[model samples]
Target: MKLPLSADPPAFEIRYGITEEAARRKGYEIRKRTAPPDPSPLDALLKKMSPEAVKKWGETLGGPGGKEAPNVSVTMPNGDEVGAPTTGCDAEARTALWGSVEHWLLGQRFGSDFREGLISRAEKDPAMRALNVEWSQCMAAKSFADLESPAKAMDLAASFYEKGDETTAFTREVDLAIADAQCENDTDYVRKRRILEDRYLAAGMGGYETEIAATRELNRGALVRARTLLAS
Candidate 1:
């Protein structure tokens, strides 16, 4: 699928930064969600324990001098560190955690922006931002001073439309001009033409010839025949 940022350029940079930041921020982000770790191992260990553990073995990483923290204490189901807070976590861990959280919240705040960045990096780079800037400019257009006649102006757009080219330019004007001339010879009322053959031109015997075909062989034809005879 073509992503919005595909055609734009700088969008990829934004994408990379956002992803890196989000990943780096995750450790801090997780800390924000969970309860703070206790400095005292006993307290920290106790907090992580299931209710059943405090009762079965009491609260201790290990009883007495064997006080080494259990493997489970340091690692979680997914193998990521569990107890350390963003504040106390090592630099790398802190970077990842903090990045992870910030990018997540950023996604929520500016959803489309965040998603576009991800897409730009994943799909097309270099073109995303450039195209976005161009689009932003187009959308901001404020004036119609450059407008052209509707029928003639859309030349470049002809390919996209199904209409043929001849009727594309000034056709409406030509049609309208001829229509205006014809309308001058016609009227709205039919007072004379209303009755079988009111005052409107009539054939006299048969229903007045209203059709061009019937009148073509009448006086009109006689005039043409006479002109031909004169010429001969």
Candidate 2:
């Protein structure tokens, strides 16, 4: 099987001094952006894919017979078991490059702790809470009541898809998304949240500097190896 290689640097290797700095830059970018007029092409295509088509695409990557791919189970620090598929050329390439899929999965699971902490702290921040209240009120005015956050708005949209005609669900979801974007824009929610998030993220990263540095070093090495592999 042939695997596609990307020329761009691995996202893991692209850091801006620290997590907080990266978050600040991202927040700035978000403040300068506007919502798109329509669903992204990937989203549109995913919504249009039939079950049979999805299965066929899976088979193309996972070999013939359309059987479900094998899964590798990783037990998290919380003792929860998460299963990730170990199939397709991409998975094979990752396993070859990383040495062990289980190790990579475990790293991913634990590596998110800093981000989770940052988000948790940010959400509880006074400024972020005040912004959420304002955004919720804006959403309420748009008839999408009780939306505490953008995540909640997304959950509400996802609920429509769970038990209705897909086309109708998609339309309703789009309308809700548009309303959400409007509310967020009116409240300047993204920028405000990002500011708070960056503050918390930077503060939180102080405790994880060693881990973050180690991860970045590993990522840099992996990128070098990947480039060598691709060049050959």
Candidate 3:
């Protein structure tokens, strides 16, 4: 796919944008939201409460919404229903419970095996479908790491490096997709997909090596810059 911006653009285009007001409004909203020191209802209540009252009743004496406390749903800027604190649970403890429940539920349908069960279940449910997307992403990353062939690796890097960035699986799941694509084919009376495929037949490749390399390069540069600054 072609990139959005041209290799070069006019200087005037850089200074002016189509929606100056909209951009300004977005910036203002971000500032306003960030200005609050702590924006939870619990935090607000504690701050407004009298020092005497705080001393008498210590933090978290169990408010009106105990175990059955209403879900502390918050309206994010976007209309999505992200996690809000449910009633009767501390943010950390209570929130952690949900993950356990989700896992147990998943295990019932799928199994303990991560991708095997996840992919199987995801085939049936929309929520599981999202999980499958994650599964694919992970498997892809795993695939790229064990990459054996420079030719195939070059192709993967080419496909995802289409959108250049610092890490493995840069713009797409090229590695994982490539592995999945070749997995079935490779299983039967094998033909070597790459020149180096046989050398590291045991080691195998993963998908996100590009991103990982990019990240390592960035970190190495940062380390050098930091060390230089410290020495100076």
Candidate 4:
């Protein structure tokens, strides 16, 4: 599979410091992603296959195992070795964008650390805590009580699976998701959350300035390469 460049920024970037309207728009987009359809018969059959059986089936079908890309490894800034090998169009696309699989892997590691730090800081912020209480109350009024934060709403929805059939569980989940979105809108949850996240992110970014700059440069170069590859 070939990875396509997204017009939108990464979710972490959108959550961290985007404008209130942008944040709300992103929240709406997230809420619209409902549960997937029921699994098909083919999917059910695949679930019954052992890992060894799956591997043998793939081999019979000429899967990547027989012509795997050369394994590549790189030492991260933290001195940990990272190894990831890709095959086919995915490998080719990644090579065009990052020069090697190692570079893409390094970017992923840095991005993960960057996202984790920002999220941790925002979640613990005093202002954010106050906002969550307001949002929770809004949700409670809609009969979805005891929601700690908007993030926890999905977990609550998923819990329906333990008590009911898939169809019923999915319906309840969708209802909860709709209520969650409404509560967020009524309480200005996304706007307030974004403001707090922006404050925390601004303060935190100073510590990761070098990493951020390198990531930006990597993305800019990748965009140019992506366009060139597409044209070719």
- Model 2, stretches more than 4 Å misplaced? 1-113, 227-232
- Summarize candidate 3's per-residue lDDT along 135-200 as a digit string, tens digits: 345435554554432223334444553455635433243333344444323332123222122333
- Give per-model TM-scores: 0.14, 0.53, 0.17, 0.57
What range of 10 consecutive residues in model 3 has the weakest lDDT sum? 1-10
Clashes of 2: 0
**After superposition, candidate 3 runs with Cα above 4 Å error:** 1-21, 24-30, 37-232
* lDDT score, candidate 4: 0.64
Superposed on all Cα atoms, the candidates' RMSDs to the truth, in angstroms, are: 38.6, 10.2, 24.6, 7.7
Model 2 agreement with the true structure over 22-78: per-residue lDDT tens digits? 332332122122335567885577568886776666555543332355666765433
Model 3 residue 151 CA deviation in Å: 35
Sorted by TM-score, highest first, which candidate order results? 4, 2, 3, 1
Q: What is the C-alpha lDDT of each candidate?
A: 0.30, 0.61, 0.34, 0.64
lDDT of 1 by residue, 1-232 (tens): 1111111112322111112233333311222323465489766776787776664443221221222522211321122332321221232332343243222222222323333333324223234333333323332342212322111112222322244553342343233223222221232112211331221123222332342233333434445554766788
Instruction: Pick out the ten consecutive residues of candidate 2 with the lowest summed lDDT.
Output: 9-18
Is 2 or 3 the stronger prediction by TM-score? Answer: 2
* Candidate 1 ranges beyond 4 A from true positions: 1-117, 120-124, 143-232
